[model samples]
Target: MALNLTLKPFERIVVNGCMMRNGGRKTTLTIENRADIIRETDLLKPEAAATPVRAAYFLIQSALIYPDRRDALTKSAQQQLAKLATVFTPQLARHVFEAANNVSMGEYFTALRELRPLMKRELEVLGPAGLDPTSPDELPRIPT
Candidate 1:
């Protein structure tokens, strides 16, 4: 099976750990093999993984993109998922579990897709950290 992706001008994408930027025009990509691909706009940065679910997904992404730290990343991801598994809603829990399972089974991209639901909404799954992932910014800051 082949997947067709159309990228707009200046669009950036990451495929199997390679970051590719389209030229100054619309371009289409045909992926014929099982590969990981994410648009630049959809790329979750580590700092931007402010929510627990986002953090969990970031861990999986890091592991997949940076093989040098796979073990450490996987361990952290597993721990976070384990903590979340016991406290989240059944639906969210299922996604977390499935994502974790996918990560463990070396299906990193699928794992990220599985976590989409949890990352989209404001949630209240608290663990030892007791951080509020849903709280809005108390004060806006000007980035340096």
Candidate 2:
């Protein structure tokens, strides 16, 4: 199967670990085979991974961008998912579990799709004053 992607001017995308930016005009990309592709808008920098869910997303993104480190990245993402599930409501936790399952099955992009909603929910629940970005230990913990 082939995938078609359209990029706006100056938009960037990473294909098989190679970063490419579209020229001044809109461009369409046709992925003819299986490849790791991620858009610039979806890219999350390590410094921006302040929330637990965002951190998990970063790990999954890394797995896709760096196949050589997929094992370690997947493991870390799974562990973080477990912790996040415990802290979130059961409904929201389903997203975390689904992402973990996808990661385990080598579907990094699918896993990222699952995590996106959870990331938004996390921000909605935490709000601005709720988190201390400088300290990760301050993240919400599971109730005993």
Candidate 3:
């Protein structure tokens, strides 16, 4: 006799340290901190909002990259996030890019690391970091 094994659509499977599963399934995990989410999504802001996002991005990125600077970096990121919230609408801002409540810190950090390159590229394209709401020159110059 032969037997067949079937898997549920949302069943969790762990292989080689990675979890595989379908979407829309809730888990018991809880993420108590919002910093991780902010760090990951801040990197994808458009050129216009790049300055503040860049500040937040580097602050968080440095924290992840250097243990000694973690506290300082976290503080800096918090400041930048506050500034960002004041300047842009919630829907248009990158400040809201946070991990879901169930996301783990390790997973959040890994995702941030993966997003670093794209963030760097966006910053380069944006140029001359530092938020200046009143400076018309801060606008990116496109080739004529």
Q: Highest lDDT: which candidate? A: 2
Candidate 3: segments with Cα more than 4 A from true spot: 1-50, 97-144
Residue-level lDDT of model 2, residues 38-112, one tens digit each, is 999999876567788888888888888887777777787888888888988889889988998999998889999
What number of clashing residue pairs does each candidate have, in the order they appear? Answer: 0, 0, 3
Tell me the alpha-carbon RMSD of every candidate. 6.5, 4.9, 13.8
Candidate 3 or 1, higher lDDT: 1
Please report, as a residue range, the 10-residue window in candidate 3 with the lowest summed lDDT.
95-104
Please give, for residues 1-144, the per-residue lDDT of candidate 1 as tens digits: 999999999999877778889999999888999877778877676556666677787788877766667778888888878877876679768998999899898788888888887776534344424433333462111121
In the range 5-92, model 3's lDDT, one tens digit per residue, is: 2334465543222345644654433334432223222333224333645545544554544455555555555565555555544543
Model 2 lDDT at residue 14: 90
**Ranking of candidates on lDDT, top first:** 2, 1, 3
Better of 2 and 3 by lDDT: 2
What order do candidates take by TM-score, descending? 2, 1, 3
Runs off by more than 4 Å, candidate 1: 123-144
Better of 2 and 3 by TM-score: 2
Give candidate 1's error at residue 144 in angstroms: 27
Per-prediction TM-score to the true structure, in the order listed? 0.77, 0.87, 0.37
- Cα RMSD of predicted structure 1: 6.5
